[model samples]
Target: MDLIPPPAADDAAARAEVADRADAYAAAPLLNCLLREVAEPLPRADGSGDRRVYRLPGGRPLRVRGQRRPAEPEVFTAGNWQRIGHTELVKLVVEELVRHTGLSNHELPAEMIDSRDAVAALLTARARATPPEDPYLRSEQSLLTGHPHHPAPKARGGGPVAGWLPYAPEAHARFPLALLGLREDAVVEEGDTSALDTLGEAPPGYRLLPAHPWQLDLAARDLAPAFADGRLVRLGTTDFPAWPTAAIRTLYAPGRDLFLKFSLDVRITNDIRRLWRHDLLKLRRTDSAALSAFAAIDGPAAWLSDTGYRTADFAFEELAVLVRDGLRDRVLPGATPLLAAGLVEGFDGSPLDHAPDPAAWWEAYLAQVVPPALAAFADHGVVLEAHLQNTLVAVDAGGTPVQALFRDAEGVKLLPEVSRAAGWERLVYCLVVNHLTEVAAVLADRHPGLDPWPAVRRALSRHDLPEVAALLTAPTLPGKTNLLLRWTGADGADARYLPLPNPLVET
Candidate 1:
């Protein structure tokens, strides 16, 4: 059967018509800001009328249409409009655009669409009732008392001194650098520590600098640079204080990089419970076991072994080591295509909605990268959290998914009741279907040759029957499954309670 084509291009008059529609829809001040910042008028694909497309600077493209609601002044009421200023609302507009444009969620930046500068300024003004800097920093001993209030003091290296504020003079006596990601091996002289040594050495043609002692860990290791200037720069703390609870982001380097995340709420201990379940039921039962049984497996299925769990700690260290070793031995030797394409950068470069060809990228991910990952997981009884955020795609020079890196402990799953099955399904749905499908749609929109189902089939083919059966028959696991179920319902209701058979037939 012939494939369904994208919208046909409209003429100039049609473009004007589309522009008028956008103008009408952009009547709200917040939407107007979005129009100015990210929206653009375009010709209709069907050649019937005009259309408006929204895009971020150097990011993905999206089509904007007026929401079909009866005109009501209350829709733009002051309180309602104020609510629209939140980051979540901005993300909603962005997500809608992604759906309309058929781009993957990855191509879209985290900021997606944002309000006008005026709105932002006004909001900032309103929130200025308190100082931007924490006021409690002044009382030294008082701040230390608050340490017990923190959730992960041990993770942050807090002992009996846990509650003490490292910034305070009293706390400084013991753990002066406690707030930073400084290396234990680092030597200190005249109050300055040695510069951090980056992994992979600085790539050719770029200047290198010692990373700040605080930035010496795995995430920083991936993006280490060589600086010719020989200047000592502070790489800031790799942790951020959380809201309400005193939990901290384990790998947050201000102005640098952020890694796999989990909620600070103490109630949820199984942050990566879903990943473990998926790996156990899907990968271990399928490809890993099947390949082992047949003696046809290639390379080490690290996901199936204990080594895989250890390797997860330092930013895909196992894969990075494999690649580095390959290069050292002249095996898989060459500069990574992502680096060559200028896609590899420090934390400053990460934005979800910023790919040039998001559709092409998604296609490559599903076709080439995902299948291998599924096969690897199946062999090792490893469940991977291949969510949009955890998985980093490095495009080739042509902006294709040449390299895929999955990070974040939350995204890594081990099996055997590590977490609840319901929780596991929720995580799977969020990471696999909810997140990746969004990106896949975008890819399909831009490149018709890239089909998502075919990619899924290819992944399944690489594994065995029982593993696929587990995934296909698994109940809706908790986490973000409720959100997906809302969108999947008949008029958006929970249908998981209703009877439904497994969608996939056993091999």
Candidate 2:
């Protein structure tokens, strides 16, 4: 693997140098190319502070402290190194090394083991045999994905003709609008006796009452409160410009306060179905008191329905609804003073930043929020999505989290199927690693000296239920990795890159 020399120890000098290098590194076309090949980011230590650590996707941590004594940098205590599969690491290392060293592939080392034990032994031997001070001794790896290019498609004009309101340009590209009805200007009323009658007539091409396949069953039962309460007046769609994933989300506004999410992709749709299936089933089997307690708490008001539709490609097929107010105004944007101010910022401009106290945020979340949620699921064999977006932070009068409103029933998980095998790992990765890590990072940035792990442990304890405290102290599930690296400052100039390990695990 190609090894970049450690930056100078002088803080001021290193900062300037690292900044310059980071800009060039981020802009490098060759780096992007390499990222695409590896399917992950190049691993490096955050050089900003004393603890120079390595992080990876899914919260895997490798501590890479460099001692610049004998003229060489030695990476110490690279724990969880075995979890990433040595072969994948070797491939990434070899490719990056070839690029940096300008060496042919034929000159690189060959992989000889597939098992973790063998790979660990090999790494130990390699570390010992190599000269500690040799600049070329350490190998670093990164994945190269292709550049981001495709913009989301724009929504086609249709349904009733009303004043066109352009959505926020930067928020998203594609917009989905619910079709209410066609305007009378496009068609004439049949046997109209007056101008008013003519103006109210339904257009010829417009179906007075078109139904979404997923809503058919609910519609037949006359169970849609949004339509009855005048909440879901129209269907709205939006894209995630910031997120690279190919998902077009549609929101059904039941009221100004409630929203339903629908996606065009089957994978996401099916995942939702699996999640809800488990949740509802668990609810059915759970004690009435438990269910009632959950219902009483202010959670996201929602229900899942496919009507009769099976595919995700159909127009306006799936639907969900945001329930009416059970939460206060400060945290809920619709109810706050910031609601009217177009320029007003909400929750530090990110849902993850909604907490008042970073340390307390995790404390209340795990202790009060996650336990009831997981218990609600355990009672009925359901698993909630509980990811960042699917969850809403409901604060009390003091802005403390009294309740957690978990929405998106489609993302709920069933116990036996989801918890067993890799499903549990996937859930933990998405909810804790991917989602919670962002929140933790923001909190740590806001409040220095506060540890994020206690909060994590609290939540895990509640999820484990009767064995809560023991679970808190127990060793976390192994083989999970989260690799998140933050640049201490500007790149390539003199910046330190620290990779944080999965905080869920004890060091």
Candidate 3:
């Protein structure tokens, strides 16, 4: 009934709405990153659950008015506590981080602001937009606040709303791919790229290449010479629209049962979304291993393989489009494959949003997801980055999770590349800390008095891996420090984590 409710009548109410909405949306992740990385939580003197407090670097007393994801920040100033909006909160982060790390960062502060502003834009745009008819697409686009642990998950490279909204999945965007023809001599491709050539006819001496228009736009300056020299020729746009997935760089074209991942020159969470040449070359090895692992699995688990890629030799990373396998082939018959991240984010048809049988649903979800990841690690030595976005779950009509599919070879760690010890640590972080913890929180939050951990423990305990026993008994798990990493200007891929209390352990 309150969808797109009228704006507040008076200026005061309107201002309050902006602050209240933006503060909660923007502050949560920032506080999550900060509290996890830098801020030290002080015990609540009154032992009140509603209001929790923390101390920043240099003993700056900081108190937030909520939990799960902290909000309504107030700093203990000269005498009493004073409330700060998102802007002041960001400033507090910068100042505290500067002192804490003994280094000043120029870009992260701007990125923090950009992320908050982006959230505001997304909130406004979503109110006016119509959600997609397909529950899968709707779920894909529902992540307004993405990567709940990242410091600037929604930041679009500090660009204005006008620049990025057209291609934003959060806006339910669907657009035509920019068609280009590369001189045959200048084209580089490996594996099954035959599907691309059929998109449209190329000139006698050229090869057809479809690109994300946004990526073409971003790489314009670097690509100007290629167009001028006639190495790259425009062939107009695709007749059918391709829907961008939750991973903004990837698009799913249902008409073709195809997924195309393009190189966008913007940072998404940890790294730039470009299909780096190094990863592109090694795709076959990683994907092959994943494919084999899934094949050996007992049940309905699947792996979405990144089969191949095509790009102009001159602009390998810029013009690259990695061809990822679509769901129709591997998805269980009579089941709908929805992105796991989308389910966690919650959309119109999220099965977990309100399950009639929370325990069974949770158990089913774990059975579908956990084993494949563990078996891949133990049997095939394939360490899956089983974080939410990289996973998909197919559900029956009754909304019970039936199958799990994992993707993203670029993130997969093969045996010998990493020691079993290191791989297990990474696996624990991605599967348990990033993926299961959030979902379990949601389940516990939604189904009151139901602790989801016991079910998770039972599910994981069944895995025969030596690590599972330790995992079930470990005191803490690795929690990635996104805020401190960014503040210290560390490489995005250089993941550093601190110990977090493991819920799997019984007191």
Give the candidate number with the greatest TM-score. Answer: 3
What's the ranking of the predictions by TM-score, best on top? 3, 2, 1
In angstroms, the error of model 1 at 115 is 11
Span of 10 residues, lowest total lDDT, candidate 1: 318-327
Global lDDT for candidate 2? 0.32
Q: What is the TM-score of each candidate against the true structure?
A: 0.36, 0.43, 0.96
lDDT of 1 by residue, 247-315 (tens): 222212212221111112111111211223223223223333323422343431122111111112222
lDDT of 3: 0.86
Model 2 per-residue lDDT tens digits across residues 210-292: 22233333233443554464423332222211111112232332123222233222221112222122233333333233334
- Each prediction's Cα RMSD? 18.7, 18.2, 2.8
Q: Where's the lowest-lDDT run of ten residues in candidate 2?
A: 134-143
What lDDT score is found at residue 85 in candidate 1?
Answer: 26
The models' CA-based lDDT, in order, is 0.30, 0.32, 0.86
Q: Which candidate comes out best when scored by lDDT?
A: 3
User: Which regions in candidate 1 have their CA more than 4 angstroms from the true location?
Assistant: 1-363, 419-427, 447-451, 467-507
